[model samples]
Target: MSNQTSYDVVVVGAGNAALCAAISACEEGAKVLVLEKGPEHKRGGNSFFTDGAIRVAYHNLKDIRKVVPDLTDEDAAAVVMPDYHEDDYYEDIMRVTKGESQPELAKQLVNRSFETLVWMKGHGVKFELNYENQSYEKDGKRQFWGGLPVKTENKGIGLMEQLFTRAQELGIDIWYEAAAVELMKKEENICGVAVEQDGKRMTVETTGVILACGSLEANKTFRSEQLGDEWEAAIVRGTEYNTGDGISMATAIGAEKFGEYSGCHSIGTDYNAPKVGDFNKPGDIYKKHSYPLSIMLNKDGKRFVDEGADFRNYTYAKYGREILKQPDHVAYQIYDSQVRPLLRKEYDLEEATYYKGESLLELVNQLPVDKQQFLKTIEEYNDAVQGGEYNPTEKDGKKTTGLTPEKTNWALKIENGPFYAYPVTCGITFSFGGLHVNSSGEVLKKDNKPLSGLFAAGEMVGGIFYHNYPGGSGLMSGAVYGKLAGSAAARYVLGNKKDTKITN
Candidate 1:
């Protein structure tokens, strides 16, 4: 711990959002300090474990080239990366949330997404096309699906390292293993945070505070209370340090709660995945998104949800919750040689939890399910599959005809020899509940009044996500709100009445 007792802005957490805030505050001429709950190796909350794909509104190839200038003419010709307009972005949010997301917050997220990506680029953050996760090539053309097209270079861990390096270059001090325990409030005004580091505790005074520590995904108690009892057995897909410290601390100090407390960004992960994410491997490998291209069977060998109801990006987050409702919270994604090549890169990892068999019956024999029931289920599904042109890039509507839970798209038969099945369990990413904040990123009270000296961003700022989330939007939301919060906090500390926007 430093002898220094104060800074102009104090940022809790050291992930993408906290780094963005710290960088923004420092750029605005404020002395900023970042407190990370984990050690140096495990610093970047959930953001570290992600692929760092950002879904931003872009008009054309020219707009994308601005962020990734290295994009060559050949590259543009090889891929079908369509322009995602602002309205399209907004509609995705509203449609996914069923109009439950706050309008103002959604507008801010959509409108400011591109600008935030540009800002990060100008600040030395590199971006590249997410070839592995976002697109699948067919007929000599790479067609991108899911509206998300770009990702940080080297993915999440790379993004965090770049941000941390930039913060250090700008003289922003970061204290690793410094877990913030409480928010220090002076009457109704926030002032500083009390953090514990190296078995010692100290209070660091600050003119403004930014809470970007993350959610309660790793906290079993919080999950049991808010999500459901079934979530107690869910695996954590991110950092173990995000146990709702920021949310709890702010809520204790009059911060209003908002959004779907019962909702979260969960996904189907390898059943044998460790309780916490492995820093060495990151998190993408633990994910089993290939279910979209397979037939997901419960323990009874009965199909539950429609595996191809939508694009994998659109439905993957919510399917984990559905998996939790299954018997023993277990599900198996069955596929054959015909569909094997269509599986995502994550499914091919050496550490992936899967089994291979020469036939469907052979595969079910390996799985913990009734062999007859499993065979019957596959026979019925195979019979229902209608012959259609198989297209992975778009919704081809190649579907099943008369199944109770129809595969609405990407329907492929499992008749090919050498079948594969992956056992999966639910893995909670982050909760969609936390402190409420305005467009300017000022934390609001239960009465809708702004809390002085306090602001929030990232997963800790609610109202943007509800029942489900769009893929790649999480990182964009964090950056957008983090910049706004940092600039707002800096203005408050500088005694500036006018709100200034932070831009490159």
Candidate 2:
């Protein structure tokens, strides 16, 4: 029998953004069909790999702090505001995008950020707000920041499941393994998509279509073209489904591309460097594994980053510089016994070749290294920490300054036993490269007009950010844009003036 499907709206991909778009469209009483390229409804495209931290203007940790006892407004805002807001956040966004990030579009995202959160709350996505009163996790173990009272939950997959359930209840049709191979355009407008279903070609027609097929992180062709030759060979340890299907389909129809921020990184070589767990922590949960000050060596064993900044941020900046200068473009993480168990508990740390020797001297004996140079590096760090000599990486802004053993909690006397070491390299997390869309989630062409009958959200669309990424911003953008794209698409379907696709 010949198979066919049609809908008022067609949502592509199975990531968080795709789920949200499908649910929202169905909730609005539109006939929706969701196409998942992956099988068995497994949530492993890109969203499954996310921390699921939602950033909005309302009911944020800051708002909760306002009602909580004994907390001042300034203090609460100071704590959470660093997370994100309009003025400062927008400046950072535009600065990295080099003013190419649509400012008008950014304004809407900033303004509606709080409302978007409220909308999700009205739905059922849970977050780590005022927790059930738990103790803070410090020393980089499964906790947030350096002892903030804030609670954090990482059930982003759970949120996507809820939205998908809502869509199912609304009678939205979801087709698994139904990969969209092409966009069906009628005249100058996108009318539907040609999706592969059960090894057969099928057409799904709609008045509106949303593209959320995710990024080119795993696509060497697209990444090399967008991020240059360096990222071509960069090991991608994450999702392999994001082959830039959205970008390719959009580009076929004259869509513009932006945001070459491909370099946001973390260590993901082995178990100690698992990219999947304890995401609430600043780094990838590896730094807190009782790692000593082994003088973070580059390919040539020279100190690069401060060894104190979150490894995620460290890897990004480090790889950006080191990859170009060195042939292999890698580094080594040296530590001892204390790191092994903690890294295991915090993550699947069994991925590394670990060693527990009688002493640091013995641990060094196992690995081929300049024993004298290693000893001198340790001695220099001990002196600086003992004498309180400031070893600041950046004098003006947030720099390492000094990593004094006496002052630091992770600073246990390394003069003890059972040493350890792990070879660490950068793990490519979310690729910031995506389609060019205004803040209102309208896909833009080179001429700056909204591509008629088309919209995009999530990591699949770009142009709002350029090179650097601020923490929590990318995930927040997905939620904000989902709301924007759905509501804007609804307006276009209802024949209203498309809102200015502007952002902060």
lDDT per prediction?
0.90, 0.56
Candidate 2, residue 432: Cα displacement in angstroms equals 2.3
**Model 2 residue 405 distance off true place after TM-score fit, in angstroms:** 18
Predicted structure 1, TM vs. truth: 0.97
Query: Evaluated with TM-score, which candidate comes out highest?
Result: 1
Q: What tens-digit string does per-residue lDDT give for candidate 2 at 438-482?
A: 776778888989888888988866756555554445556776787
Counting only residues 3 or more apart in sequence or on different chains, how many pairs clash (N, Cα, C under 3 Å) in candidate 1?
Answer: 0
What is model 1's C-alpha RMSD?
Answer: 3.0
For model 1, residues 1-504, the per-residue Cα lDDT tens digits are 456878989999998999999899888889899999999999888999998888899998789889998989998889888889999999999999999999999999999999999999989999998888888877797888789989999889889989988998998988989988999888878878898988998889886999999999899999899988989999999999989998899889889998889999999999998889889989567899878889999889899999988888789989999998899988999988988887888887888989889977777888888778889999999999999898878888999999998999999888998999899999999999988999989999989999999999999889999989889889999999999999999989876323323331
Q: What are the candidates' C-alpha RMSDs?
A: 3.0, 7.0
Which residue runs does candidate 1 get wrong by more than 4 Å?
A: 496-504
Best-fitting candidate, scored by lDDT:
1
Residue 109, candidate 2: C-alpha displacement in angstroms: 3.7
